[model samples]
Target: MHQDFPESRLQQLLPELIAFRRDLHAHPETAFQERRTAAKIAEWLGRLPGMTLRTGVAETGIVATLAADKPGPCLAFRTDMDALPMEDRCGQPHASTHPGVAHACGHDGHVACLLGAATLMAAEPERLAGPVRFLFQPAEEGGGGARVMIEQGALEDPRPVAIFGLHGWPSLPAGTVGLRSGPVMASTDNIDLTVHGRGAHAAYPNRGVDPIVAAAHIVTALQTVVSRHRDPLEPAVVTIGSFHAGTARNIIPDTAELHGTLRTLSEKQRRASRAAIRQVVEQTAAAFGARAELQLEEGYPVNVNDPGIKAYVERVAVEQLGRERVVDGIPVSMGGEDFAYYVQQVPGCFWRLGVAPADGSPGVESLHNACFDFNDEAIGTGVRVHCGVAWSWTRKGQLC
Candidate 1:
């Protein structure tokens, strides 16, 4: 028998949904490396009656779209398939099989929730009045997977007016959701600094221009890029993540390499920080008779939510989950996501699905953690959020 949309059915499907989550978690894959994961997703979606499955959209990515009997708007639900590089410490029965790869960011849960939604939508396609697209996106960890999928026209054909996505938050309790109207996430950029100097014997101090000293100066100066160069009111961050140089303690190395990450909320700040970072590296290296090269790679854009769409989704979330379960004015996450790339193309909103467990669990474990796992109880609420938003937006009454 088909499962009902009522709360009881969502509950009834828990065991199966939990199994899906574990299967994916046990065999986590990294960005652009989700081959088996994609195949399993294709198999799962194929069992649904009305789904038109498309695999290899952007190299190991899958897209299964469900069309309603009655024509209406198109709605998208995305689930990232890649896992982060981390050892498992959760000690769960389904610990990661891949050494150094773990579903620490709750991507396993994200995939399971999307599958759960597909199961419900297929069983009750009549309840769905519009076209629904299930985007099993790959490489969301850092590879700009959404941009690649969109470039291939994942949003084409029906061309959804709004795209919705959810992420697990361990901070908020299981039933509640984290939401916001504007600037929900920060933009990310990576800077690689290369300093060139003359190598010499440790005995000869005057003969060599030490790149390590120059790198040290550059790193220290970078700390002031946001504080000294940018406005205090605007939010920006420049962090030196790694510094590498010298093989031997006795001899000076010829080249020193330093890499850092830059994050900003505003475009102006993003641009300004990039320039300032380059300037600091070059100027510091020049003072020590060495030269510096800087390469700045453009990363995920900032996540800006459409106020109207955000309000509509928030309302549906409250109605289905309860008033207290829906929250607003949540602080923006410093992490970057490819969903920003999609919202950059169309009007959309990305929200938080709280998977936090009570019973005195530790505070939120940031994404990419080795021990982190997504909460399974979030499946029911997540399905309701997507289904309700799609139905509410399609109903004749309004454009919610």
Candidate 2:
């Protein structure tokens, strides 16, 4: 293992990094409204010598670059900055101050880890064979922040040869890293459907078309797209999260609205499932003598880790933390991640950093839960992994 940043140095920085993570948790911001969060990050990066800061990219994103003396490929490390729009019930001293907004997904810890890496790299810029770009991105929670950052030229200006990112995984024990080669996270697409029918009096049965009945049928039939239409081996989800129809119990409403999400692991499945959903909704509604309108909003793409980049990350991780600490072939998740956008543009790898309690405690709160908080114990490991990857990737003659 190449110890560019010694364990003692990383241990000394852990307290400050934990404090920063807590501060971010306390003052959580969501989506593009991360002005204060970006400011705090900018202030921290500003103090590091030889770091170039660019704020306000894609509304609330920030990119800090540290260039090496010799020329080599630029490698990018990304961290998300937005919090989820949910209440924080952790009851920690640094619990979220913002109402209905919290860092329940451990993005706060991600930012702190990247910042720690930046601090170490900035202190010894000569070790870098090329430039290292630290991307503090906003709006990872359903806002597609990664796409916006790319559109705003965050990847340009000495474009990076590859990108790397990580998310906290509660299922894995702390200090372990989970690496996968492809389709680690699924693609997310939204479904908005409206069934139109003629209103009728409750007392009269045959007077008008019933949209409520049609909507019920539509929901039930949509499941077939996942179970019967797609291959059983393939993973897919069609969930109707919201359904609204009649305001009063006495009358049949003229229209009913249905809102749901679609998740698929492969593009072939995604496209096929979408077509099947539209067909099912329309044909089922037609069978009920009702007209249906379906709208599909494309969300993030499937987050695929480049095979070579994944191998590179795995090597660095195994070197930094022992082979036992580095886990391979973690199960794929149905959850969506905007990091898919970055990988689509450049060869990138997004791995999982374990945040579960190291002491083997049960009942660790899962992500997006009201009481979920990032494990502070994982800070040192995360920082070490990020720094190790950056250092090794930026070394001369390194290829990812």
Candidate 3:
């Protein structure tokens, strides 16, 4: 590894980094609506010499490839650029400028981190042997931005042998890197259950089929998919996140809908649990004299790691960010991510970059919360970690 380059350079670029992030944070964009954000990023990336810019591959997504004079394997580093529909409560100077649209998911910080890496690669061109692909993806907040990019040929051409991406987590310290070898995140799928019941007057006790009653049954029984059908050792979660029933208590509504997500770390569990839920919802609703309409939407897949690439990430985190802050083999999370789509196509590893409070005064605020913001100080460290991994993975000779 090259030791002459210093992290001090990151401080010099901080003014622009912080400004870019805040400006984008203020004018937050939702999935597929990141035209301004995409333009801003493309403008910044274009300033860097020797990098070929490619935009509009997947609906406002931007990809820039940096090639070295010498040839080696290609490695891609990705960052999701999108905002959630939460309000900004961080109260920081760079707080969300948009109303009702906030960067509560720490995506703003992820973009800054990848940009930091790009600056470093630009500075130390001679040291990098293989090519580095910088992916500033859009629609990561909820839309399937990652899926679109891959489908549009981001991973093709050089066809990166290994891809690496990271999520900003608030559970760990500001500069800590949380890594796992396999099944790091759970698969997420959304199913909406609409129960068709006959509407009738509330005064008549036996006039109509009570959809509220049927919905209660469906909700309660779906939980059994995890407790009864799945193994105890294996991780599984089926949560009914939303339910909309009768509009007025006096009148029994004809239709009631139940919406929720199913999370699992294993593919077998995902398939089995989903099938079980469908059957249970249909059967349970049918018994109550109501027909069921179910719509299951596919979401992020399980974030699994490549054994070879995962080992390299550990080494990079320790050397760049320090060993004390680099955690290994943390328990997997139930949250789903579209990054799984990319991992499915190639050998890759997805890890969490922790940015939570260490003193316990202001502890972690789970992602998608309005108060969440990525620790800006950690941006430089993120760059070092990515470069270190790229070098280790694509270098001709390194720790094996």
Best by TM-score: 2
What TM-score does candidate 3 reach?
A: 0.95
After superposition, candidate 2 runs with Cα above 4 Å error: 1-4, 68-70, 394-400
Instruction: lDDT winner between 2 and 3, please give it.
Output: 2
> Model 1, 1-400: lDDT tens per residue?
1122456766787788899889899999999899999998898899999999889998989877897345777788888999988897778899898898999989888888888888877887877758888899999988899999999988888787778898988778887788999889999999888899999987896899999999999999998998899989878889989999999889998999988899998898899988888888888899989999889999989988889889888888877777877899888888888899888877888999888775547644666666677777777777777767766665552434
Clashing residue pairs for model 2 = none
Worst window of 10 by summed lDDT in candidate 2: 391-400
Query: How many Å off is the CA of 193 in candidate 1?
Result: 0.8
Per-residue lDDT tens digits for candidate 2, residues 1-400, read 4554577777788899999999999999999999998999999999999888889999999988887334788889999999999999998999999999999999999999899888988877776768888999999999999999999998988888899999999999898999999899999999999999989997884898999999999999999998899989889999999999998888988999999999999999999999999999999999989999999999999999998889988888888888999999999999999999999989999999999998899645999998999998888878888877777764443633
For model 1, the stretches where C-alpha displacement exceeds 4 angstroms are 1-5, 68-70, 395-400
Per-prediction TM-score:
0.95, 0.97, 0.95
What's the candidate order when arranged by decreasing lDDT?
2, 1, 3
